[model samples]
Target: MYRAIKYKIPVVTAWSAPGTALLVTLFPDISLNEAVAAYITSAVVIFFIGITGYFDKLLSWIPQEVAAGMMAGILLQFGLGLFTATDTMPYIVFGMLAVFLLAKRFSPRYAMVWVLIAGVVLSMLLGKINPVTADFSLAIPQFIAPEWTWSSTLNLALPLILVSLSGQFLPGMAIIKLSGYDMPAKPIISATSIASLAVACVGGITIVLASITAALCLGKDAHELKEKRYIAGVANGLFYILGGLFAGSIVMLFSLMPKELIAALAGLALLGAIATNISVAMGKESQRDAALITFLATASGMHFLGLSSVFWGICIGLVAHFLLSQKNRNAVPVTASDSKRV
Candidate 1:
């Protein structure tokens, strides 16, 4: 429906985040059926909730860079996890890295497209793709029959809402701002939430607005230079529907792709985003220590008090920052240029 999608760039960009999830879930022994279901459910909920004025105010409060960093932090583990399984497909990783770096340095606008193209070319040349044995079945949309069990609701639904809110939605706001695009955050949020709800009803995982990778779409480096890039979102929605329908086929195709490919491509895809976030997060001397602590704690994989380390880490870092600031404040002279005795 959106005009930008005609070029297929936005669709590719949109598909990156969910597509990776799809690949990981369907290919490996473990399937993220619940996560996927949650993602879709979340998307729908966000979409509807976005129609409110509250979301507009909320978006204005959060800083864009912080949101981007938060997104990168959320996906850090997923990207790093690729390296662990890259041994089986070294070329995929190498190709992804090579093209990614080249694109970033040379043509930021088309980096993702090039990386994807390179990945495909390298995979074909390396004889890594197994098209012959891949399955081509379609997956009919299956509705999730919600059973009201305390554990299921609390452990799954509640946490998902929180994570999507704090971890996903807030950060998405930051990203929208960071890219210098003052688009209506509420509508987008509501749209994504509603999309999530739709997916959840159909046995899909929740998908909140993607703050981290959304930059890939919004950034100057991702899409081909054009005025109608919004079509990319439309393309993304189409791919989502297609992937949902041909989920079996898509999964089978991804299964044949190398692990290194997934990892390298993911990491490569996120490089620009990561650099921008780190730059902004560390730019201010006041927030540097706190932000770094937040980054490390999130990256550390440590958990305590029934909370993810990322959330706790930011909380702890914020407290430390505030306390340390008080000490510094007490020592500073009340007036500027106070060389004379008061």
Candidate 2:
């Protein structure tokens, strides 16, 4: 629901990039079945929130700056991974950067894709890719019957849903607003949740609104006419379907790719999103303190009482916001629209 870059790729609900590394880290022993089941549960819960219009009610209390702050806090570390990767894989990183810049110069929308292609090529050339056994076959969906328990539901399903809300959905809603689109929140939320639930039976772990990625397609950069830009969304859905049709082979390709290569591509893809989110989070004078608190708390990677840092960030940010604002009684309150200017 948050920010979108110009990739125009299908925004998969559950992707395995470093983006969901927190989930992976939280559930170290996460099996495909468990992952899928957790996603299914989370998706269904989110769908209820959407259909009941509870998500809109929830958004009212959360100012856009705080939402953006939480998002930036969660995502800021992603861009930094690119710099870290550069220190170890100099040629591959440099090659990817070169391709990113060149692609941006020509076809700005596909710059991230080119960076990914560059990573694959350079990694292969540098002898980083491991040889894999060949299997020429159509991708078949493996039905994973889920096993759910109180502990599993609490730890896995809840966290996945929270992350989907804080990590993906909130910022997604903000970005859509910032882009000046009058889109309704619940319908999109319901659609994604239903999709995630359906896909989970076939091993998809999560599906969320491509918030940041959707921004790429929403802007004038995607199309000269704002109204026509929705074509990008349609195209993205097609890409998602195509990817699902070939999920098994895609998973194999991803698994065979070096961790560094995947990390580099992920980091590169996130640079623009990170910058934009930071700008939005820090732009307001009234909300700056709250935003900063949220960002730092999230970046600290705090986990408490079995909850992730993202939830803590929002809680801490709101506390900071209320406390600081109370102390500055003379100062005019910041409006949600005002915070969204960035």
Candidate 3:
């Protein structure tokens, strides 16, 4: 959701997806099953809602290259953050970077292949992986029995809608707009709302268009062939299906893989996406400073009021974008075109 909200890329979206799992670790009271359940629910919601195909329209808003560049910029810290946490991660970092850079330069279709190979090799060499512990539990849906509590629905659904608009839809539009798109916002937000409700029915938390991470897929830096961008959603959806089916096993496999490896692989995988976000965000004279600040702040790991840096960074970026835009209002008459830029 980061890219859709900000200007991050897709691989970074995958990396960020796993971040939800981090909550499980941090909150010892929450089981891995519960944490993953939320994600799975969100995926199902996203998939069904995506049937409308509105996202395709969003493609026109932003230039593919600029989107890709901004994506890479947004996720710059994730893959590298592994090294700070552990020594073994650096190896994965190297392998990930090597393959990712190679893919960007030569064959983007095989970028994920490089990451998988590196993960396998590194896990074997480092003794971080184990097939034995892999669990095979299917994630059966658990419906959250609805209670027509007006207070609850308003409190829950309203905020979710608002966040999806400001947090997810706005940035999603931004990614496309930054890339050079000019699609309508109503349909996109409407799709997200429908998706959120669907997922909520299946016990999902909130499923919005991923602004921050979707950029990874939409950006050119994601693959050597520019068209490979869509592969992100395809890959993510496939993984989501597989992940939901084998949630237990997936969790175990990741658990066996050292944290450092996961972090590095994630960071490396996101390199292209981050680079794209940064480049595009910097391209505009008016938005450059604010975008950079947002990029740095989001990448900085800072948090406030239980929200991640991504959330706070967007808030700061929006404020900056608004302030800067207003300041330039007299110097440069604001037009409908300029209004649509953010």
Candidate 4:
């Protein structure tokens, strides 16, 4: 709503899961204060990157197949969690899975909604849902001073930028474009980056253009008329504001649900993204070897020299691509005329 009115674009923004995960991975055991500082630094850097319009150049530096492979590798665990949850709660897990598959086939947009309903009903019937003591008070935002650290700059900040750009913004912009919107990327990036910086002090991750939820609004289900689809975006933003006010209550509600249920929900939500990335990663014959190397390296969860597996995945994949391309270029084809001349 804000971005549309202010920048006159139809893009919507949300807190990025991948960006949050990078922060968690970087500062797993750190205090909240320290985490906020790291987030602030990342937001500042991303804000500058957006305003200067350098994101396109940075994105071009990385191969699309390689980036998709890395993203698939990163999201693999969540996809697996949907099945792994069955070990602990077979009935609920399978019930939700069935509902998701059926709904996905018949009415794809409402699959997650059906899955959530099935999970809740099955859990409640099976005595898995726990009672929560709810608080109706508004969430109090805390202010934390930004502290710049060399390690965070190198590790967390850099990865956050890459993942948010590649995993979130790229696909998000693609989704919008596919829906026939000629929305400019620079304004959207600048708006979200500024929003992220503004809210970082309140324990917020980077605000990014959403890919998954944005699809709901972009499709015919949102509105038959394409020009009027901005209403859905505005409605989403209004609900987000309302949800943010009761953030603590929402946290408590999720906390009351079984961990298995949460795991299943997340897995089902990411199924499409996982499938898409995997297809892209293995799609091209020439890029298959490099993409596979990247995927395996990233999914292995290995860390070296204080860097995450995602970094190593891209490095190894790029090296493979370069060498393979060089080999292809240097190989001489033998034809009838060439053989006769030889």
Candidate 5:
């Protein structure tokens, strides 16, 4: 709301799931303080990039297919969990899957909502919901002093910037443009970068322009008049503020749910994203080999030199692309006359 008012453009920000997942994966390798510092550093760097309007240029350096492949690789585990979870709680997982498929077919927009409701109901009936004894309380933001390290910057911050830009901001800006908005990318990126920095100490992830939710607001479903659609953004922000106030309760509630249930929910929720990324990664026949290499490397979970597989996946994929593309470029096309002569 502040940025929208200041810049006179419609902007809505949300916590990026991919960015958060990247940081969460780092916790096992780095200290919480280091992860915090790396995230803050990423936000600061992204802020400068936005202010200077260089994000587009930066994005141009990374191949979209390669980036998509890396993301697909990173998210493969969650997708697999949707099935692996069935091993323990077959009934619950299968029930949620059926509900998701039915809801998706009929009410595509509310599929996840239906899935959640089904999961909760099934869990409750099966005695899977854990008793929560924690008292409801307002979330107190804890400021952790960040400790920056070379590993954290290379492994966490760098991958975070790449994924957040490729996965969130690009799609979000495209949605805005598709919706007939004349919004510039600079202001939105700049605003969210600053917001991410502000909330980094409180364990907030990169706050980027909303992609999926942005589509909902930009559509006629939000409002009949396009100009009045900003009201939906405002309403969304207000709801987010309300949710933030009771973050503690939300956290406690999730913690009390069965881990298998949570895993199933996450897997189903991300199934679309995983499929989309994989399709994009392999869409270009020329880039198929490179994208596949990147995806496999990332999904393999290979780590070397204290860096995650994501970094290596990008490196290997780019190298493969360069070499393979160069080879194709150098290959001479045989002419029909030449073939007849031969």
Candidate 6:
């Protein structure tokens, strides 16, 4: 639902069915029962956090460059994923890359779309594309009566709140900020959290702001007229709905092609956004080192205290920046005294 109505700014949940399977394998006792319960509790907590509107105050203290740096580091992998994909599907990747380059050279804005076309057509010709075999089913919403326990609330619910806020929401807002959008923290938070809570009853886990996918829709490549870009987001949301309705069929269809094909297409599509953020991150001379710290930490994918690298990246960069600032301030008095003696 979030992806379907993302342009309307509803936050939705995402999942990896394989990851869920692994969770079941690891802890047979933990099942969808706990997931729905924990998810609802987490959403309530997040919604409370949003209503406080404290994040806006926090944002004021965080320099824009640091945020940009973290985002650049976060997205750098997507830009580089194309090369990794080339190792497996060289022909498709090569063809996509060629079209991407040509389209970029000529049109710049529509290059990524052209590359998608090239890849899909080439895949079809190579007999790599397969027809959808799965039958359609109405995605009837299901409900699970939540079992609220101290352990589940603490272990699962708390972590869900933390990870979703630090991992998904923060970076998503950063993307909006870097794109010159004015999305206030409170409204976006309240809106997504409410959406999350509403869906939790149906055993749904999401409708959160999307960082990577949002970048694709919000970037300059989406349209020449900047104001018109929201339309792209609307379209993306509509597609998400369509895809969800026929998820089994669509998943099988996407699964037929090489995973690398999709990665390459997405990577090529995001190149412009990635490059723009990198430029913004490292633009200022004074902020350069701090920005580098943020970038390296984020790109390194370090996670601590149950949060993602993006959060730690900002913390580390700010610490380094404060240390450097203090050192410079302390040196100023000594330099003045030395000059007076001379």
How close is every model to the real structure, measured as TM-score?
0.74, 0.79, 0.65, 0.78, 0.73, 0.86
lDDT of 6 by residue, 1-342 (tens): 333244443232343222233234435565567777777887788788889987777676677788788888888887789989888788999899999889988988768778888898999898778856567675666677877777667766776676667666777777787787776777767777787778777776744667777777777777767667777776776787787677767777778877778989878888887888889888987788888999999888775765567778888988977887677778745587788999
Cα lDDT tens digits for candidate 5, 184-226: 6777788888888898887887888876566566655466688
Tens-place lDDT per residue, model 4, 290-322, is 889988987887767645576677789889888
Global lDDT of model 1: 0.60
lDDT of each: 0.60, 0.72, 0.55, 0.77, 0.78, 0.73
- Model 2 spans > 4 angstroms off: 1-41, 102-110, 130-136, 146-148, 215-225, 330-342
Model 4: lDDT to the true structure: 0.77
Worst 10 residues of 3 by lDDT: 7-16
How far residue 150's Cα lies from its native spot in candidate 2, in Å, is 2.6
Q: Encode model 2's per-residue lDDT on 249-310: one tens digit a residue.
A: 77887888877676677677777657777788889988998988988998888878756687
Q: Where is the poorest 10-residue window by lDDT in model 6?
A: 10-19
**What value does the lDDT take at residue 322 in candidate 6?**
81
**Residues 128-172, model 1: lDDT tens digits:** 876576666777766555544444444455555555565555666
Runs with alpha carbons beyond 4 Å of true place in candidate 3 = 1-74, 85-88, 95-108, 133-137, 147-163, 180-183, 221-232, 300-311, 325-342
Q: What is the lDDT of residue 226 in candidate 5?
A: 82
Error of 6 at 172 (Å): 1.4
RMSD in angstroms between candidate 4 and the native structure over all alpha carbons:
4.2
